[model samples]
Target: MSRMSTPAESLTRPDGSPIRVLVVDDEQTLADLLASALRYEGWEVTTAGTGRAAVRLAQELTPDVIVLDIMLPDFDGMEVMHRIHGHQPNVPVLFLTAKDAVEDRVAGLTAGGDDYVTKPFSLEEVVARLRALLRRSGASAEKPANVLEVGDLRMDEDSHEVWRGEDEIHLTATEFELLRYLMRNPRRVLSKPQILDRVWNYDFGGQANIVELYISYLRRKIDKGREPMIHTMRGVGYVLKPAVAQ
Candidate 1:
């Protein structure tokens, strides 16, 4: 029987080291479930069921990212985040809460959280959100180089040049940034919200069509008369990879 693959299985840090993540939730079942899912991405995952434990693990492990629950048995996630923030101010934190109010989300962001996800959320959304945070935080240990290569796609981070195979492609600054993100996570499917957050640097609200427009521009430049690389997962989002063999 063939086994099913998960979204996390396709993700990797540019440096090739396992990305470390600390999961903090008062519910042990939820915490373990999240840790198991993240581990599928080849991440070093640690779980803590209380705020105190969360702070201790955050200090000890120095994880690249954290998924913290808002309600904890001892103290709230905000206090735990404050404590950990003092030690590793640069580390990214994603708040998971059962509360879905707009004010709650705002409060979490105001409290040093990098991202927020409400409860009863899809695990895929959490993973994608964490991946976006990791990228924004520069969790990779490798020094950035002028050039990035994913399959035949190449991007010069300094000169803002792009090439597919031997053909040079011209792109606007926005387009270049978008393509660079795609190249960074070659085979992994990235959601449009994630794209907007990383490439546009803010919430685009209902301007998701912007992503489609830029994707069309990219396809025209890079995929025309060539083995197409950019793919759409219908309702999900886009992915960049080598052309599938016919």
Candidate 2:
């Protein structure tokens, strides 16, 4: 007898709606199976068996995340991704491919895929990747407070305004949320896994370098010409605290 997989507990939106996901694959059985697993995670799942259908459904469904197969029946997966992006530019995409070559992965990422998984992958890994993508893109269900402050940096969640000392700093929504997470836990050493879980809301199975990338972005905007408050604990994690006197 086949083992039955249990659905993992997941977070829901403020309105209690499940996160939306679009699964695209030329193989009908694969698409349905993937959709079933996603639905098991308590997400709203839509499936498309062709690239053109995927693009059309993406527009109509406006899913929070998309799982796209690199190979398609009617059109190239990349072209489908482009078409869908034309309508919903910020929707996160995870490419599914049978090709495991570096070039294929690089091509998919270069074409604006947020992440990807090679074929013959476990369903649990796919779900985790989707969760991380949603978290990084601010598509997660949990919403923070209206304002957050740490040191001289202030972020007004309502107006989406950020200020460092006397100057106002502009940040993208993702950056703002990352900063808020850091500010919320001042002086605490947060490892990459911890940051991924708390800030991105996923247990990432890939590289942790994304954390470093966002940290550098925050430093340039928040620490430039000021006492640096974001500190790296070397092989541990990161800490945010007040800078000391010179």
Candidate 3:
């Protein structure tokens, strides 16, 4: 951690080191883009094009964060996530899936994916989410109280507001709660039941549709015309991930 960092960097190890990230995807171009974006953010970055290679690299050089794609040429991303977890359970995994299907999302969650993003994503959003994840993980990255910035998206927890650059984002009470939860945890998968418990009153007897409706509302407002951030996990729940690779 202290090896590849410096002072003045926002998120770094306690010794003032840059956060290191490993990106796993089959698409060389997409992985390169994400690696470049992360590196530009002052974090050390690496890439792996297959599950086996990803696992091997992670073992040899541990990274603070891992951006994993669900689909892979050798083993699937889910399996790769498992192997990584087997090696290091506490490490955070942010999934890069093609879609927000319930099955894929649940599988990733069950397999221990911390967070994820769908395809055709904005690099800015991906960067923001990664930074936020590092902050939440307390992985010697950033402080929790610090303002979280992902691309143009910014949220000041102390102020309880979100902004896309200079423009402010208007959110309903429920929307605010949902977004807050997602931001707080960053890349961790929050199941529907889990989200309900966290966001709404535990005793409140709301239908699942409430969760679905809120997700739709959030997507429409937060991700419309940009990239899908909040996503659905069929037969499971929802997650906030980065843009998925094609």
Candidate 4:
């Protein structure tokens, strides 16, 4: 019920062994605890105290999954994820942060994070979420036609096409990326800065309205003449769901 419909799970290789993982946190103790828990779950684990070290370690280790902290030294954790993703696109990221705000969660998700957990969380919960993230990440992503259906709207990853019933929708590169990101997440609210960081670039420099502007553009093309599929959650961010006929 919680899992999204992305093909990320099928991307797993048949190693039939523990998946290697990297954990990055400024707080070394928390990092160690998480690493220990992951190791207990039969996953090989590595730890990084700084973002630069995390990137270098990720490059060297080629871990299957990453447990990344949003706050870091050397570079932003978002940038670290981006750099690591460039080397390994399929690796899933589970974000660890002290910021428990809805907007922060939105930012992480939009930044391509598979999951998030606020600080002072249980070791068991962290382990469980990391496993789920890995499973989702392992899912196959080869075919863009592996469409993720949220409601009435369907997005084709293979063809980069979106459809609302009989209507064929065209999207710009950025729009498609935005939609794809939202689709990958299903019901999660995504923030503008996070959207900028992940969909645009890790070092993205732009106004927050870039997200609002693109949202307007997308709604015009994808939601016009139909019930609203995308919604604004007030001070939080944006979430995409099925269009409910009122």
- In terms of TM-score, the best-performing candidate is 2
In model 1, what lDDT does residue 158 have?
A: 54
- Candidate 1 lDDT for residue 188: 93
Q: Estimate each model's TM-score.
A: 0.58, 0.65, 0.57, 0.55
Using lDDT as the measure, what is the rank order of every candidate, best first? 1, 2, 4, 3
* Model 1: ten consecutive residues of lowest lDDT: 1-10
What is the full ranking by TM-score, best candidate first?
A: 2, 1, 3, 4
For lDDT, candidate 3 versus 4, the one ahead is 4
Q: What is the C-alpha lDDT of each candidate?
A: 0.79, 0.78, 0.71, 0.72
Candidate 4 segments exceeding 4 Å error: 1-13, 139-246
CA RMSD per model (angstroms): 11.7, 5.0, 15.2, 10.2
- Expressed as tens digits, the lDDT of each residue in 64-123 for candidate 1 is 899999999899999999999888876778899998666687677656576677788777
Residue-wise C-alpha lDDT for candidate 4, range 1-246, written one tens digit per residue:
022222223233345655788999988877777776666665678999998999899989888778899999778889998888787766778888888666776687566566677886777666666655544343223334487777778877765567888788866445667788888887788887777676644322345655786788789988888888889988888988878642
Cα lDDT tens digits for candidate 3, 182-226: 866765777777777776534224445556767777787778888
Residue 165, candidate 2: alpha-carbon lDDT? 72
Clashing pairs in 1: none
Residue 232 lDDT in candidate 3 = 70
Summing lDDT over every window of 10 consecutive residues in candidate 3, give the lowest-scoring window.
1-10
